[model samples]
Target: MDEVITAADASITGSKSSIIPYNLPLLSAFLSCALAQFLKLFTTWYKEKRWESRRMLSSGGMPSSHSSTVTALAVAIGFQDGTGGSTFAIAVVLACVVMYDATGVRLHAGRQAELLNQIVCELPPEHPVSSVRPLRDSLGHTPLQVFAGAVLGCIVAYLMSSS
Candidate 1:
């Protein structure tokens, strides 16, 4: 009876140890976002020498928050499921779509916004208000941005799973 009880307990504990919860993916996503934002704050502070100064929340900066978030999700999914598994494959495809959108579609839009802003600035103050529009110049992830995001995501996911 004692041996049976001990074996049952060991089996239960082993099952628990092997089971990874679903929240890990969400946590990875949140951490990536947080890390990117914190990096932005740190970079701003370093550049301006003021902890209180806030740079405009940019879309395309070092480490690319969008890339970070999605890649982190993918990495976490991969950890929960093997890389060749269906869940991991889906996550990878989704991440690719998001990264492409960030670097391609949104980037061109930002450039267009910059051009329109310049055109508006050259206009007279008395010109119609319709001529004025805010410019969004930070919209594309550089190679470095994507790379940093991938590295950050992989490291975070691995650590989260291991812990």
Candidate 2:
């Protein structure tokens, strides 16, 4: 009886050890976001003619980090669990929703912010509202930016999964 119990304990421990140490989908998503954010730095430098490290931490850039993250997660799930699986289906749905939000609602909000900032700039200096900080005008990405992010995410996930 003791021998049987000891063998069972060893088997459980061995099985635990054999389990994957990292969640591949999650890692792929995070890495995709990080890469997108990092790339923003270079894009900003190119367009502004000056390096701006803050772009790495800011939202709404040349490539949408939100799109990259969701796309990467979906692609990773598809690669690991098969495109026909329910998990992959869910990931696809989520990615679509996120991409839509980035290009639709958030894009509109960014435009509104720009307009509001312009209005604020015209206000008198002594106006109480004029003393407030300007709204952020880069809260979302263009359609092209979203597409670029999605492509980058897919590439990243594919490379990670293939290896």
Candidate 3:
């Protein structure tokens, strides 16, 4: 009869032990999220002072947060995985979806809110009070807004990751 050794048992008898635990993908994802958010806040605050003559907690200015977040993620993925890799491809698709939703869906939402606010003001006091506040003016990004955000995100990610 031939003796058989199990693969698991054979591996247990192996000479060397190796341990390596590093997940670059998850790290990159988190970094992208943080960088994007921080940039958005900073840019908004800057715009308030630069153009609006006020400092606000939130405002729509030059770049859209929506664009910044996705652009950061996409650039980060490209840094982590090669630009030609599947991971980067997935990130690109996700970025496109986010940008589209921001510009198309949210843009209309803002416009609707503006119209609603105007209508509410024109109504008599007998109308039910709209407890809800006006929709924020900064919901959507113009093409310039999107472009600025994308550029900012790309620069940040490249600078941080390259270092």
Candidate 4:
């Protein structure tokens, strides 16, 4: 497939290797998101001194997985298709929107959830709402987290291109 793989030249490797690994924008995007998510484990351990394995699968952390996934897709599209193309333009726009949402609307929503959770905790046990589960506050990322995720995504896309 033109967008996925190509035949390796026999003169270069002395063998007929068909599929060259890491030649995919989709894979690069996926790997970037996974790496960012995986990094949350180490970041949590470093910051909180706890092995929070759940961070690897949870949303809203040190690095934004949403940002990483979109950014990696954009960068990979740019690298493979050039910035002047419509595909690259679409990817860039998509990335921008995702990053903005991660840092803006979603972040504020997370803050509101935290406040609601705090209020819920202060309620008396006899109250009906007091027995409800706490709201999940970790729903979004800060600007720094988004930036870090974007940088991580760019690095991953660059590596994919070079390979």
Candidate 2 lDDT: 0.92
lDDT of 1 by residue, 39-82 (tens): 86666577666674234365666677878888989999988877
Error of 4 at 152 (Å): 0.3
Cα displacement (angstroms), candidate 1, residue 38, comes to: 1.1
After superposing candidate 4 on the true structure, give the runs of residues whose Cα lies further than 4 Å from its correct spot: 1-23
Error of 3 at 62 (Å): 3.0
Per-model clash counts, in order, read 0, 0, 0, 0
The weakest ten consecutive residues by lDDT in model 4 span 1-10
lDDT by residue for model 4 over 51-125, one digit each (tens)? 989899999998888999999999998899899999989999999999999989999999999999999999999
Clash-forming residue pairs, model 3: none
Model 2 ranges off by over 4 Å: 1-20
Candidate 2 residue-wise lDDT, 77-128, digit = tens:
9989889999999999999999999999999999999999999999999999
- Model 4 deviation from native, Cα RMSD in Å: 5.0
lDDT of 3 by residue, 1-163 (tens): 9978687866786644324434344444455545555555566667554433331235344566556666777887788777999888987898788778777887777778788888877778777765456656556767777777677667766766776
Residue 5 in model 3: shift from native, Å? 28
| Model 1 regions more than 4 Å off | 1-22, 45-58, 129-131
Worst ten in a row by lDDT for model 3: 50-59
Q: Report, for every candidate in turn, its global Cα lDDT versus the true structure.
A: 0.77, 0.92, 0.65, 0.89
Question: Whole-model lDDT for model 1 versus the true structure?
Answer: 0.77
> Clashing residue pairs in candidate 2, if any?
none
